[model samples]
Target: MWELIQSNRRKSLILFFGMGALLILIGYVFGSYYDPEAGGVVGVFFAIVLWVILSALSYFAGSKILLAVSGAKEVTKDVHPQLYNVVEEMKIAAGVPFFPKIYIIDDPAPNAFATGVKPENSAIAVTSGLLSTLNRYELQGVVAHEMSHIVNRDILLMTFAGVMLGVITIMSDIFFRGMYFGGGSRYRSRSSSKSSGQAQVIVMILAIILAILGPVLAQLFYFAISRKREYLADASAARLTRYPEGLANALEKIANSTHKLRSANKVTAPMYIVNPLKREGMKLADLTSTHPPISERIKILRALQQGVSYNDYQRVFEMIHGKKEKIIPDSVLKESIAVTPVIGLTNEDKDFNPIEARREANDAVMKLNDYNFINCKCGVKIKIPPDYNKPIVVCPRCGTRHQLR
Candidate 1:
């Protein structure tokens, strides 16, 4: 496990510096494009400010912000006891130091994600669609997968990488907008030396090119690392649940779901267990995707026939890819411990009701948002809006009169 952590840290450092250098270079070029003087310093200052503000937010309030952005409401056992139990089981299995706070998003898209810079304090948020759709074993697989992200300490890396990518995009956008709006008109003059004029023109061309390519290069870097970490998280999920099929099935259902994740945006798409954004013609299963192809992930997981361990997943991964390239680092694989799948029905499964679960999900989110619930005698429940000023309400279904509390 230390080897895994160490490897991630090493990769994160390289990504940090590599992308940081690209960001600084873009700033210098664009700054020089506008003013060949100290404008470069001002440009760098702006970039730094944007990066620092976002970085600080990531370190301090990232988890909260992401959950809020996803419209997740904090939930207790009473709201969804099965989800609580699943998360607790995974927390113990993964040996995470703390029991992460749980949240439920109201969206019908079946997806989940983990966030927080440190393992000691973190959170796992899942959409209500996931809760209502997945069975206990399938849900356990997803929770374990999210738990792995916390244990492996890659949340910070992803967060900061996203921040850097955003900064580069913003810097490039500003430069291009300036050029389009006549900021580049002040670049050179006939009074300057011929050699100086030529140099200025060269800088302007380079600036334009950097502004165009900056976001694309940054996205590639971000997606490359994102895909690697995702594979690792999947392998860890199988290890923790000792049931590769569980996660494989979960992925299948998620991929098949038609319900769009209305809460997802471009920035938060990578944090999800699957890509939530729907591009018109983009094939997310391609090589440059933010996530490994769902079909490929399912195939590899389903191929693990022998044991449940990092080594087993690695063998399966290689077998499917027809190559020996390692997904889990060598040091970690050498020291891996194995577990067998726990079969049979869990207590939560016998009485599990998807309809009830769906209702619970909706009710819990409404309650958290301050909506009042009224139980009618005719089995119809009425939800009173928070802003309703009337002292009494009539049930739409039962036509029963109820007083607002």
Candidate 2:
């Protein structure tokens, strides 16, 4: 496990530096073609400065930005006690440095994601639909999965990659727009001679090609790492919770839901437990996907007959795909010790009622909005609106007087 963390840290560094280098490369190419003198060096300097600023923002404020983009609102334990308790349990189970703040997105998509550079500065967000759809055990499974991402440093790896990908896409769009508006023709006309003009044109062509391919390559880079990490987080969740079936059941429910997430975009979609953008047919080995197939993931979890360990997951992975290839590193697998699997809640106890879940979530939201809750001895729960402004409230069912506080 330590080896995997170290490896992820190494990958994060590589991604950060690789992005900075690419920015400098693009700036130099554009500057040299535009101004033949020392402009290329100046462009490189500007790119370096921009990269530092962007990297800082990515590390410091990326999670906040993501939350804002998803329209997620932070909630206190009082606002959603059940959800809060699940996060707390998973945080302790995963042995993270701190409990991540919780956020809720009021969307109908049954999906969740984690963000931040490290465990101490992390947050886990779930769609309101997710809260309304999953049972307590299923929610625990999802929360554990997200917590394991924090434990495994997947957030840092994917966040940096996302930052780089965004930079490339922005730079590419600016370059193409400049070319579309006669910036290239103007530069060509400014050349000293026909030979110089032709040379400049060739550089421009190369720059254009680079600009076109740069974001695609970065995106592919992100997807390559992301898919593997999802699998790893799944395995880690099973081991942490000691109930692979919980997650397996959760995955099946999430996959079966047809609700589409309204706030999901390409940049934020990969961070989700399941790919919000994926349609029905994408497979685990799909190169373009940021997640393994839900079916394959569930199968691997169910196949962990011995126990939830890296060795068990790796064996199942290879068996399911019919190859002896390694998913967990040799050192990590050797170090991983399986524990006895524990029985989970029965199907009768685990049965999720979506209507009840939805009502609970709505009631929580109302409470957060300052609606007063009154409990009657007659087993009636009354919610008084803020505008009611009544000194005393009478329970319609039991005729009990309850003070509105």
Instruction: Show where candidate 1 strays beyond 4 Å.
Output: 183-187, 279-285, 342-353, 359-363, 366-405
Could you say which candidate leads in lDDT? Answer: 1
lDDT of 1 by residue, 1-405 (tens): 678899889888999999989988888787777778776887777788889998998889988888888888888876677889999999888775698999988888899999889887789999989987888788998998899998888898899899999899888888878888885747566327788777788988898889888899999989888888889999999988888888988888898999999999888989999988853224544556788788889999888767878988888888887877767887898888876655544454557688887777777777767787777999987888799999999988878888776
lDDT of 2 by residue, 44-142 (tens): 776667666887998999899999999888888977889999999987887656989999888878999999897888899998888888888888889
Lowest summed-lDDT stretch of 10 residues in model 2? 182-191
Question: What TM-score, computed on C-alpha atoms, does each candidate reach?
Answer: 0.86, 0.91
